[model samples]
Target: MNKEHKIATSMYRKIAIDIAQSVADGKYVEGQKLFGRSVLASQYKVSPETIRKAVYILKDMGILDTEKGSGVEVISVSKAREFVNRYHEIESIHSAQSDIAHWAQKQTQEIADVIQKIQFIVDTAERFKNSSPLTPFEITITKESTVIGKSADELRFWHNTGGTIIAIKRNNDLIVSPGPYATFREGDIFYVIGNDQTYAAIKKLLFE
Candidate 1:
């Protein structure tokens, strides 16, 4: 890899390790507040994105609770230990109970971090897959309605009823925005978009 890429990757890993160790060592004990992204970014001399990435990793490990608007907080040591114990066989593995407990807590946080990372990827893929086109269709509009004529009440009413006017095809032209000021004229074909229910609602509105 290039020098810059290598350095960035190394820095990212270092940041993750530092956060994990801090949580492990009780440097930022359970329930204690951690700085927000902007604050941490300044403190660590890293970009906001870098701080976000690090915080997200910590959050996945269950070591941190990052609530939007509220800021990040260290998870309770007891709770952190509890989670760690579930993923690993802590009780039977060690005779020295205190050391075992400490190790278990740390291990649990690590596992949580891994799971969170994997889950994020899985969720993103699922969303993309679901968004992929499963089918295609052609519709022709037969009405005259302008955004000004239809008004906010009509647009909202349509949206609330699950009917969406996807596009407006005027003479030799296509207007897709269909914004608040948009309009539909007679012979203007509208490309309505939505699922079965939406399609059904459109048919009802048009026919009725």
Candidate 2:
């Protein structure tokens, strides 16, 4: 549920476990009476109702004995130790569940970010396609390509392939309007704009 309510519930459970631990440790022997509810509440800096809840848990687990008029008493150190061990096991399970939930949330956010980036690329492509009759095509330069280390001007790129180079992508960097002086390199992606036959022509010119 909400954080505040969860915290309050945990506090009462923690108080119960602490009291049971004291009994198990022999700090309070069997048959030893505990402080009254009001005194315990004051000592623990909690409301009487919180103390009542803690005492109820201990009594239910056979770690404490209580009567309407008399104060609570330690009844079984063995049961008290058992209660503490059980609480720890349950706590470990809850911790694991929390870790799984956190990881799931982080993965969901990462997926959302990836989707946003893809959508942006799609929208930009649509706008570019609408701006001119010719759509842009991308081609990567490989080490064996004939165009390697050759500038667009030197290769007579536009005259040979009928495609105009608009940009070049080298690793993480984008060189917009890289012009006739931009030299081809292995691993560089060229963004070119041309007619339908331009793609085949560029490929034949670069590789054949």
Candidate 3:
């Protein structure tokens, strides 16, 4: 309803996105119960209610399911993979729409700003529609990961996995299209683009 509320909503959207990416990266498996509200809130440094809101978003996206006895868990792996392939563009469009709708509700923006937001929404839609088959998924670099603490070249990451790390989200900053010299570290989330074979290799390297 207000600027502060919009900001909070956007933050929750981000939290929801991070969770979906984590699922896609196999950090959280399908049919596996997710972390509790307090734990997730702590991890994202947000309130429990914010975590709930993020979970609600995931439910709406069909990536999460809940029942009385079973509790909360990710949906089928097929659906989860579908979400991973397009969630970024979906988030962009959703955020743009939310911004535009909020501005309309408050009558707080100039015509130019409204146009810019609309263009962003349109551009995101276009990109999503035209995306290639090599859409990337997020993968965290853990201490046990073979690539951890190694440069891409030293590990032959791209060659071995047949995927390229297009982005690295370390802490609060995101480095897009990082080079081979960009060494991996524990806790870094790498955005990797590859095919089914590439994904299998990645999963074997990271999980098994």
Q: Each candidate: what lDDT?
A: 0.61, 0.87, 0.77
Better of 2 and 3 by lDDT: 2
Candidate 3 lDDT over 1-208, as tens digits, reads 9998998898998888788878878888877998788898899888999998988888888889877666679886566667766876787899999999998866644555556644654454345447856655678877777656678888777788988776677885566668888888899987777776888887786656
Looking at model 2, residue 16 earns an lDDT score of: 95
Off by over 4 Å in 3: 90-208
Clashes of 2: 0
TM-score of each: 0.35, 0.56, 0.41
Residue 92 in model 1: lDDT: 41
Put down candidate 1 lDDT per residue, 46-114, tens digits, no spaces: 888888777776688777888878889887565455544543464345546877788999889867765
Q: Candidate 2, residues 107-172: lDDT per residue as tens digits?
A: 898677656654654565567689867767899999879979889999899999888887777885
Q: Which 10 consecutive residues of model 1 have the lowest summed lDDT? A: 133-142
lDDT score for residue 182 of model 2: 94
Tell me how many clashing residue pairs each candidate has: 7, 0, 0
Model 2 Cα displacement at 136 (Å)? 6.4
* Best-performing candidate as measured by TM-score: 2
